[model samples]
Target: MIEKAEGTFESVMRAVRGVTRAVAAQVDDLVQRPDVLVVEFGVELSAQAGAVVTAAGASAQLKISLTWNK
Candidate 1:
């Protein structure tokens, strides 16, 4: 039982880490691009674990807008 609980915790941590990395990358990209005027991102995650089954899923959406200064 302890091993199963540990595995579930590890799985959840990995998913959270992945999401953090993805958001960091997006921020880096926006910072490096001089033409970016506005940016937005949406992230969602779902997980299920139980004695009989385990599942996980994630999704993300990004939007960027740019305009000329002159």
Candidate 2:
């Protein structure tokens, strides 16, 4: 399972990219074994702060959870 894959980036898009990469890595690891059946995948994005000044200053957090039935 993957959890708390959080990152601060220059923009929300970048942050999402980071989280996506993290999740993909985890999924790739699971799929490599050939016997794992990935049953569920979940992602949670935390609420953004109200006062985002600029794209260069934006931040985001992500949580990823994965469940497999072996």
**Which candidate number has the best lDDT?**
1
Q: Candidate 2 lDDT, tens digit per residue, 1-70?
A: 0222223323445655666777677677874444342333233344346532331232334455554546
Candidate 1 lDDT tens digits, 1-70: 5565567667656766776677557666863544445655565545656432235455767666665554
Q: After superposition, how far is residue 44 of candidate 1 from its true place, in Å?
A: 13
- Stretches of candidate 1 exceeding 4 Å from the true structure: 32-70
The TM-score leader among the candidates is 1
Question: Candidate 2: where are CA atoms >4 Å away?
Answer: 1-10, 31-52, 55-59
Candidate 1 lDDT score relative to the true structure: 0.59
Q: Per model, how many backbone clashes are there?
A: 0, 0
lDDT of each: 0.59, 0.45
The TM-score obtained by model 1 is: 0.46
Could you estimate the TM-score for every candidate?
0.46, 0.38
Q: Tell how far residue 4 is off in model 1, in angstroms.
A: 0.3
